[model samples]
Target: MTAELRGTWLYDAHVDLGTPIMVGPTPEGVRAIFPVTGGRLEGPRLKGRFLPHGGDWARIRGDGSIVLDVRALVEADDGALIHLTYGGRLVIPAEIQARVLDLANPDPLAGDRYYFRTLPLFETASPGHAWLNGICAVGVGRVVTGGVAYRVYAID
Candidate 1:
């Protein structure tokens, strides 16, 4: 099947958003850790997965998947603000989970406070001439603030 994002206006449009996603300074420079995987767009739904940093690797025994959904809506300042939904278990130990209540919430945990803030706008390699169907970013934090560095990734 042809890649959904190929030549789709969002390709470059998303790039313009920026590189080295900004994140707030937290303990351990830990805010800058996001793992992205499975970025494939299906029909009206965009799907992907995100893995937070410092989480227990043992928790993700098998191939883990986080659900992502977005619309084609793009704003002038925000670029493409597609609503995202993440679903999956965090790798933190049960003891840690008890303390970090925020781990369950995708938005806050996926931002600046913990490890999510380090995400760059583009983390996946472009499937030549194809639109991205699914994309995932992993990390732990609260509020993906401005200040954290980012690194842009583009597949040729």
Candidate 2:
């Protein structure tokens, strides 16, 4: 069954949160520029794919596309569950690394503790960046109001 995801409010929130208003060149020429054009809500889920613009930044850059797919489900007045999955790949030269899938409960206790569950299901197209595996951690945080931008800190 297809789920209805909503992203308007959160999209605005991301804007107010100062979600990088510009697309700069990638630090690594091999990487694609992110958050391209046309990112919006597909119902209750936030779905978007970004690609590097055609330029010097897009040269050595591989076919690695940045994928952002998220689903939001509200639990209570102040609690919510967000399921997110994202991945990047380099198809041309065949170099992929740091593929991550993390499940986060931003409001586990609905107020007190935040929790995260990470699946061991991760792989790299090449071993050159395999070291990224050991340094990965599933993180969870609550969006606290900072009067300016959205602030996310470890809840516990």
Best by lDDT: 1
How high is the lDDT of residue 90 in model 1?
30
In the range 18-56, model 1's lDDT, one tens digit per residue, is: 122324344323232233321222222232222222111
Runs with alpha carbons beyond 4 Å of true place in candidate 1: 1-88, 102-156
Please list all clashing residue pairs in model 2, or write none if there are none.
4-44, 5-43, 5-44, 5-45, 6-43, 6-44, 6-45, 64-89
Return model 1's CA RMSD, one decimal: 14.8
What is candidate 2's local distance difference test score? 0.24
Q: TM-score of each candidate?
A: 0.23, 0.18
Candidate 1 CA-lDDT value: 0.26
Displacement of residue 153 (Cα, Å) in model 2 is 31
Which consecutive 10 residues in model 2 have the weakest lDDT in total? 147-156
Candidate 2 per-residue lDDT, tens place, 14-52, comes to 111212223444564433222222211222222222122
TM-score of 2: 0.18
RMSD of 2: 18.5
